[model samples]
Target: MARLFNRTTQQGSRTSLPMATTLPMTLFMALQSRKTRYRSTLVVLAVLLCLSTYLLARSSSSASHTLLHKDMPSDDQMPVVFEEASHSHVSGTARKHRKVHKDREQVTLDPSQELAAISSFLASLPQNVIPLSVDPSVTVDPQLVLDFDTRSPRAAAEVQHMVADVWLRNPVFLYSKLYSPASREVKAMLAKMDLRPAPTIIDVDIRDDAEVLEPIIKRLSSSSDLPVLLIGGKPVGSMKEIRLLDKSGELRKLVAASGAVVDGSKKKQHKH
Candidate 1:
């Protein structure tokens, strides 16, 4: 009985030692688990802080970019907008200039058209009558004198008619010698007068009366020159002198002073 009791006690002591060892191991394990949980929590908090900082930095950068863009003009819009504005201004100016040019053209007369109208009016006159005529006694101006031979009556009549038509003044015709050598000079003078605007002419054929012209020829110092031009009873040179006066614009004033209507349209046509 004593031996059984000692063995049982030893067994009970062994069981108690095992229980204490188990309690220490369980406590160490619980502390380790708590430390691991704390470390995990700290890691999670650090990660969250880093993510929040990153997000804040990104948001600030985005906001700064947006503000920079809003404060300045866009590169794409600057040139296009300004160019369109400039073009509009230039176009408006050009249109105004074009309008002025068009108005000027509308008001200005065409030179060719005016000339044509004047020509049409002149062409519609009677065959034998002059365009305009004035009586010599009505005005105190000079009378244009012409001496002609009537041997060729047709030629002499034609010259008289031309002088009447062009000068717009009546001419006096005088019958002169038909057989004289001076008659050839009279024919030559008539030929020259036909080519130009005629003047007031006085025709004198000496063949009708030699006694009437002998003293007049001697006074003129004309020798054999049968055709003579006299202005205001004084001998003016010839057809050449008349042509020079007309070319120098003196003829218009001279004729106008004598109550002759000098047509400017005719003068321009003669120049052309």
Candidate 2:
């Protein structure tokens, strides 16, 4: 009975050693599986982060491109708009210049037209307007002699006599101011031309009654300019009119009509 019991105990010891080794091997395998699962989870998270960043960058680039394209104008339309703006600016500037040019043109008159207008106005006056002159040497104040409508009955009689004096002279009278540039120009032009009867220049500014004489001259010529011309007791015009008439050869004709020979030396040839 003792020998059988010993054999049974020996077999149990060998089986128990094998079971303890198996338990340690099983625990090591389970730990290695858990580590592999954690590594896999980290790899998946890294890949997802990289993919989301790429997508976000692409979307932002596309949005920026869209905004830039929408704000910018097309190349074809730029020149047309620029030209329209330029034309508008030029037209406004030209309009202002044309208005100024038109005003200047209206103020300057033609010689023939001015002469005809003055002649018509003079002929329309009453026949008994100017009576016979009094004394040729009498010195009458211009204010008293020219005041036909404003002054007393004696003033009207004096104006009539003065008008008669001016009418009877039949002179080429030039009513001018001393310091006027237009008057100087007219005088220079006349000096060059050969006229039979010399032009009579009246410098109103140098007169004793300058203020009084100036208005009277203006009323007679119906102009607010100096250097008014008169041919055979008829009002001719100013500097501009004379210049135009001279250019057209009408100045010589008018002078001849007024009984004044122009360039008489040229007409008379020297004997050979």
Q: Which residue pairs show backbone clashes in model 2?
A: none
User: What's the true lDDT of residue 33 in model 1?
Assistant: 100
The 10 consecutive residues of candidate 1 with the worst lDDT sum are 140-149
Please, what are the lDDT tens digits per residue for candidate 2 over residues 39-68? 999999999999999999999999999999
Task: Report the poorest 10 consecutive residues by lDDT, candidate 2.
Answer: 94-103
Shift in Å, residue 142, candidate 2? 11
List the candidate 2 regions with Cα displacement exceeding 4 Å.
1-169, 264-272
Candidate 1 C-alpha lDDT tens digits along 1-272: 99999999999999999999999999999999999999999999999999999999999999999999898886533322211112221232111111111111122112222222211212222121111232321221111111121122233353444443432332211123456454445444434333223333333342222343343443333334445433222333444664576567664455445443345456658889
Cα lDDT computed for each candidate against the true fold: 0.40, 0.55
Q: Candidate 1: TM-score?
A: 0.29
Models 1 onward score TM values of 0.29, 0.38
Leading candidate by TM-score: 2
